[model samples]
Target chain A: MEWLLEANTAGHKFALMAIAILLFAVVMGGILFAVDRPKRVPTWVVVAGFLGPTLLLLVVGLVYPALSTIRGSFYDKTGDEFIGLDNYARIFTDDGFQRVLLNTALWVVLVPLVTTALGLVYAYLVDRTRFESLAKALVFLPMAISMVGAGVIWRFVYEFRPDQPGVNQIGLLNQLLVLVGIEPQQFLLTAPANTLYLIVVMIWIQAGFAMTVLSAAIKAIPDDVVEAARLDGVGGFQMFRYVTVPSIRPALVVVLTTIAIVTLKVFDVVRTMTGGNFGTSVVANEFYTQAFRQFNFGLGAALAVLLFVLVVPIIAYNVRQLRLSEEIR
Target chain B: MTTTTPVMAPVPGEADTRGRVHSRAERAQKRLTSRTASVAAIVIAVLWTVPTFGLLLTSFRPELDIRRSGWWSMFTDPQFTVDNYNQVLYGGGTDFATLFVNSLVITLPSVVIPITLALLAAYAFAWIPFKGRSVLFVAVFALQIVPLQVTLIPLLSLYVDSGLAGSFWTVWLSHSMFALPLAIFLLHNFMREIPPSLVEAARMDGAGHVKIFFQVLLPLLTPAIAAFGVFQFLWVWNDLLVSLTFASSPDTVPLTVRLADMVGSRGSDWYLLAAGAFVAMVVPLIVFVALQRFFVRGLLAGSVKG
Candidate 1:
């Protein structure tokens, strides 16, 4: 930033960036308009028009930050040195980074699985119930909550006061446990378990999404097939196992893998709940810590890239599932 | 498709021998699969609901009682008063009612402006054929992945330069940018399902784009509009980040950030925080319940075959 400012004799902090962007948008819009004229536009013009905005956004928003991050990761904590993959190497060997990865992996696996299974069960049970709306609303309430709001609410749920330690725990969970003759447990700020606790919030918010999508898919299942399965003596658990599960398989895959990809980028809950302490750090949280807290943009960038690398395959798989569903239709 | 009469009960051994041990075990099993589920659902519902319930209770209770003990302990040390609500409404200070009005002012236009713009953009992406449409659409969709934190600094810089940083419009524009991709994606998916044949038929009648959009399409889009309205309303209503960035001034500040300050800065005053949060939540809750019917797959009645 210092070099760019020094070298460019424009002497205008905002003008250069703003004018460049506005001019680019205007030119691209004009090109798109002109090139789209029916058969008069040269093929080259059409190609340029089609690719311009995408190319501009990719370069400015994505590639620039990405390249900067890569360069920064090679540098020291202040992003001054050219340490050459020291951060990358550290990610594998460093205990902290490894813990972050393991916690993220646990999240990437557990939250999606639990949410989808719970959601599917709820959807199936409430399929044609009289109180279906009310039941669904109860579960869906969490979805309506902002992550910040939910975090704040849950903080009160897990609130601890050491000074008044035995003065009847105020946290709802501990209060209940105590009522049942169990000792109050510190749920947050506990190693490994805090990660799971964070995952629970994600699951709560995301399960409604899974349920909605899967319910739509379940409703789309052919009535004839369900009737046939019924006639074949499919009953109770067997019905869900053999008939309903297979029928909503696409929706399940979409929900699970979509969640997996999202969990890979989980940031807000961990940020709000534990501030990435107590071994609750994931790659995303680590990235934020490095970039914002520690000012190690390079390491943060590497962590972000690692996050993207992990997510890309899951995203591809999800997109492929969507395409397959489209093809089936 | 076989028309076999599949038994609703378990096929012999699988009949939830656990839940079925009781009378009407089949119905009980149908009620809840595992004892864990029943217990879990009840526990979660109660636990999850308590904080909000506390907020509600505190809204109605006196400030003194709220600060005295835990809200649940209200059962033991019962002290009831409507002083919180009184202060919220008619207190000599900045009451929540004034903040609620400010919230409405902040929320409504923020919701309306972006949704309207996104709808037009979504239509063009979904249906209009100027050229470069799919590529343009994909570019917009990809914007969904760009985290707002990265953009905020640049956007704030831009806002400062443009003399819009402290204005309400700044927050609106921020929400628009944050919301545009997802809104476009959702609306595009919906508009695509409106059967091109119907659109083509309208086109054959020599209807221009505006006419076609208004006469033939807008009515059909009511449910989508309603759903999107609810979504946008909820988002803008609940938004703190944007309000914090653009509208931190006393006159311009929306309720969420105000509520945050009230909770965090005002000596952890549960009475004030709860009352303030309740003020913020009521509108969104109303919007959620009222237009919730549009949330169903009903509008796709003739659009798709299952």
Candidate 2:
């Protein structure tokens, strides 16, 4: 508040504001450029329409900031120095950043696998059930809530003050633990377990997605094949394994890879719950930490780039899976 | 453990013995699914629902009670209260109604700008023979995966630089950019499905491109419009990141961000938080339910490739 008020008085913010508008206008203009077809709008007019807005926006809003972030990553914390590879080196060697990386690894791997598996099973079970709509809707309700909303809801579910006298636990898990004649621990503050707690949020949000995609796939499992399986006396579990799973394999890949890609970008829950404290840091959290909290723009940009890099493979796989499915059709 | 025996059973015509085993295995499978499968489905449905149920209950409980006890405790004690509802709806100075008015002010324009731009861009991509259309569509689609958070800092910086960070135009523009890719992809698939002959007929009738799109195409795209509108509404409404980063001015922030502050200040105020969360969720839920009927049949209308 103080700085903003002072900055306003000095009129520095105005210049920055103009630059922002110009950036958007240029980007929109660039989009117009690409959009221009010579016959309809006249090539020059089309080019001006597209390039004028898109380039302005991209340069000032997106491209410049991205480049600035990359540049900042090469510089020191205050965005002044020029140190190459040092920030990247710190990410690999530093204990705090390493833990963040590991937590992210566990999250990216486990959440997607579990959520997808859960969705697959749910999809199969509810495929043609009497209550399929109701069941799927229940699972997907969380999807409509922001990640932040889910995080706040789960925070209470995992909330803990120390198990001291008169604290009275609010976290449901801890409350249950106390009932079983065991000690209640600060679940969010606990080392490795906290990561599990955070991962559950992703699973909750994504399982519905998995279920929706996989259920649709399950429904699309050519009725004839299912009938053939029935004639072969492959009922129940066998039918699912041989007939259904194989049929939905492409959709399964899409769901799994989508979840993996989303997992790479997990942020809100960590930020909301523990604020990236304890040992539950992930790449997104680390990116924020380095960039915003610690003001280490260089390391932060490195983390963001690493996230982008790590995500490309899964994204490619997902796109590949989609293209393959399109081709098969 | 049981898999190897059945799969490795003798060829079907080998012996009656093998036949009996096969029939037994088949019967076993039937029994396994009918009896046991129901149990697994129920368990998963129940497990998946717990946290949401917790949120539902927390919304109804009194503020003090929420801070004092686990949300699950409502089952045992079953204390019915509207205190939270009261506090959330009409209690404080900046009540839910006021914040919701703010949310609406922000949400309406945000939804309109993207849909308008996306529809034009999507039409151009789908029909108006353009250069690099596929690449452009692909690029747009790819941007959908960029973490909104990653965009936030730069977006905020850009907004700050332009002096529009706190304005409705700033948030609306930000939302439009973020939403363009998905909207274009979905709408393009739909527009392509419109049968090129219809477009060609309009073109032959001396209809301009914009006229054909709005007068001819738009009406036919009701289901698509409704579907995308519902999604966009839900997305913008539920969105916290952008609403927080770009639209946090006193006049502009939406319910999701306001809900966060309520949680921060009134951490112990369950009544406020629950009511607020519920309020934020209500419109999206309504949108889904109303449009949900059109949802499945809308885009996934045709037999899409599995």
Candidate 3:
């Protein structure tokens, strides 16, 4: 058992993986075997066999912890003293935290809108073109890599070498500046601007998602509608504006709200690229910093609650849009 | 390309109408093939790829060369080596190979456990005659909005009390827990799409719910399973926050956590960082390319139809 927990050797890792899978198989197989036999088994027994593990795990893991964290938001840093609303108040009033809120707002507003716009245009341009699949794949490749990996790649792109003789700039952006005889700047060190740079990495990732979804929606448009629009002499920008845009309105809404929800909870890009320094910390990263690093569990819980609150309206709008789209379908 | 070109000539009857149609087709083709549109498409693709290509180029350069010059310089002064990858994977201080194994270990159980559990639960919700099924399913679906951040601290303390704090078990359990809501929702959606008459025919044959699920529904649900499987695989393998929170021991940290630590501890080591980043990315890239059809199907099903 101890080796199962602490082992690092290849043999031990594989052994533990096997043990874990075998344990799950035994437990699940036992439950199924018990339920498989015994003709005319009661409804209660069947329900228990099916929903028992899932309900228990969800209750223990998600429901209980979420409720406890919300409760903890009212307490002090140590979580021992009950200080009502102080943590939430500090989030609203503190200067540094104000910047966090502002940055979070910027990220939520900018990333989704920009990514969706780019995705729509790119999807429209590349639709039915030669090499459409390959072109889309190039954009979508970023989505496959982890955010931390994307962060590393972009961090190198944003790397700032000193401006001096014989010190050729290594980062692509800075190198371009040097080639054009302009001074190379610190891309990740400048406040606010650094936030935009980090947001660019996210846009790079999510634009693929937006494009894929919108392209499907674009293809789903009825052929007769397009043919009629063409007969009516609508083409070029007008066709995209009138025919394609309205046809994919539901998908557009879904992409926008989904990306907004994701952006609100983004942590890795900020953590990896800048470690949330230089006024670049959003609510999610700040929550981790407060809760885990700073050990301010109360404040962390507050930030988490804040993120939840912010996500609610976006989700509500998404659900409404989905319902509308389903009705149309 | 042939499809887009207006190859037909104007007909004798209704010559003006035919000309109008031909001109529309020609204009559409021109719009598509216009230099500006082609240039814009190529520019976007190049911009999106160049950053990653630069890092990939640096990954093969010698450490000294990477630090002293731009990756683009290699085109003129072409030099390359695999030493950076060698050091990043097996060097003295950074044991990323072990972390790579840990990532695999953490990801497999995480993907498998939730998927298995969610399948059973989805079947119950979709097929089994049970009370409160709709309410329970809705509650589970709604739980997707509860960001994992809200649950991290209490869950961490729970793991601490159980003495599973730094084990792979904690990471597996957390990921499984976090994934269940979405998995159940997605799987349940897929399960409902299965025709009721098939389930009824199985029921008519005196088959039990368990038998019908295995024989009838599971086979039909393969595509959905593949879709969600790819999703959960990527989610768990690429996760950093949950792994960082639970798997703190050097033995248990996954590749993303180790890579993040390297960035924090040694921010300037471009050669090693570049190679390490690629090492983290390679599995997912391969999986994405190979399973791309199912991956996109899963994405569209999960998000577009949610």
Candidate 4:
């Protein structure tokens, strides 16, 4: 058991993985077998067989921990003493945390709107182009890689070196500046601007997702509606404005709110690129920093609750939009 | 086929007789061939790809050259080497090869477990005439909004108390737990799409719930399964927060954690970071390209439906 738990070698890790999968299979197989017997089993037994493990895991993992974290938010650093809203007050009052809140606001607002807009334009442009699939795939490729990988790629692009006579700029952005006879700037060091630079990486990663979803929605626009608009001398921008936009409004809402939810919880891009430094720390990254690095669990729990609170309104709006779209359909 | 020439011409009324013949085709062609839109698309595609392409090019360049000059300079100097990749994979202090294997081990089970559990649960929610099924399904669906951050600290303490802290088991279990709500929600949507008469016919054949699920629904649900499977695979493999929290040890830490550490500790080593980033990206890129259709389908189903 100890060996399994502390497995380092390839052989042991594979062995452990195999054991875990096998164990899951056996337990699930047993439950299903019991439910599939010759005698008729009650619907409750069948339902329990299907849902029992999931409910157990969810209750143990998500429900309990969520409630505990909410409780922890009201406690002190050690979580032994109750402090009662002091942590939340500090988040709203402290200058450093205020910057964190401002940065998060910038991220949630800018990332979704820019990503969705770029995706919409790109999707419309390439809707029925000769190389539509290939073009869309090129943009969407970033969605496959981890945000950390995307961060590394963009970090290299934004890499900075001293503006010296002997030194040549390696970062593509810096090199471009040098080519145009401009001084190479520190893309990730400068405050406020650095946050936008980091936000670009997210926009890059999420634009593909937005494009894919919006492209499908564009395709689903009824053919007759487009034809009728075209027959009315509606072409170019006007057709897109009058015909296409209204047709995919539901999809537009989904794309916007989905990206917003994801942007609100973004940690990897900020963590990897800036380590939440230079006023680039969003709520998600700050939560990890406080809990893990700073070991201020109470503050971290407050931030986590804050994130949950922030997400609820976006989710509520999303659900409302979804309900509206379903009714229309 | 006969209207292909008219479709190519920009002049609209010259081919009025042929226009009505393949107007849909002509309209599609005109919509796509707008000169401004084409240029815009080409520009956006290049902007989207060039950053990653630059890094990919750097990963194959010699270490000194990569640090001293831009990857675009390689066109003139034209030096290339695999030493960066070799060092990142097996060199001292940074053995990403091991982390690669750890990612695989962690990802497979994390994906498999949630998907298997979600499938059964979705089946029950869709088929089993249980009391309060709709209420329970809606509850699970709503659980998707619970940010994993809210649950991380308590869950971490729980793992420590259970003596499972810093193990792969903890990472796997945490990922599975975080994934369940979305997985069950998406899969339930897909399950409900299958016709009820299919299940009824199976039941009429004296097949029990398990048998019906396996013999009837399982086969029909393959596309849905693949869609969600691709999603879960990508999510688990690409995850950083859960793995960082649970698997802090050397043995259990996956590639993202290791790469993030390398970036922190060795911020200047472009060679290792470039090679390491690509190494982490390779599997997902392949999966994304190979199974892109299903992945897109899954994305549409999960988001647009809800």
Docking class of 3: medium
What lDDT does each candidate get? 0.64, 0.69, 0.89, 0.89
Error of 2 at A132 (Å): 1.3
Identify the superior model by DockQ, candidate 1 or candidate 2: 2
Best by DockQ: 3
Query: What DockQ do you compute for every candidate structure?
Result: 0.11, 0.21, 0.55, 0.53
TM-score, candidate number 1: 0.74
Off by over 4 Å in 4: B1-33
RMSD of 3: 3.4
Instruction: Single out the weakest 10-residue window by summed lDDT for candidate 4 chain A.
Output: A226-235
Q: B48-107 in candidate 2: lDDT tens per residue? A: 788767778888876677767777778898887877777777775547776676676667
Compose the digit string of candidate 1's lDDT tens values, residues A95-185. 8888988998899989999989988887776665444555666676666655555655665666554435436565667777777977677
Scored by Cα lDDT, where does model 1 land? 0.64
> Compared to the true structure, candidate 2 yields what TM-score?
0.84
Question: Which parts of model 2 are misplaced by more than 4 Å?
Answer: A1-61, A161-170, A323-329, B1-29, B67-78, B89-94, B261-268, B294-306
* Model 3 per-residue lDDT tens digits across residues B62-92: 8899889999889999898999999999997
lDDT of 3 at B48: 89
DockQ of 4: 0.53
CA lDDT of B120 in candidate 4?
94
CA lDDT for candidate 3: 0.89
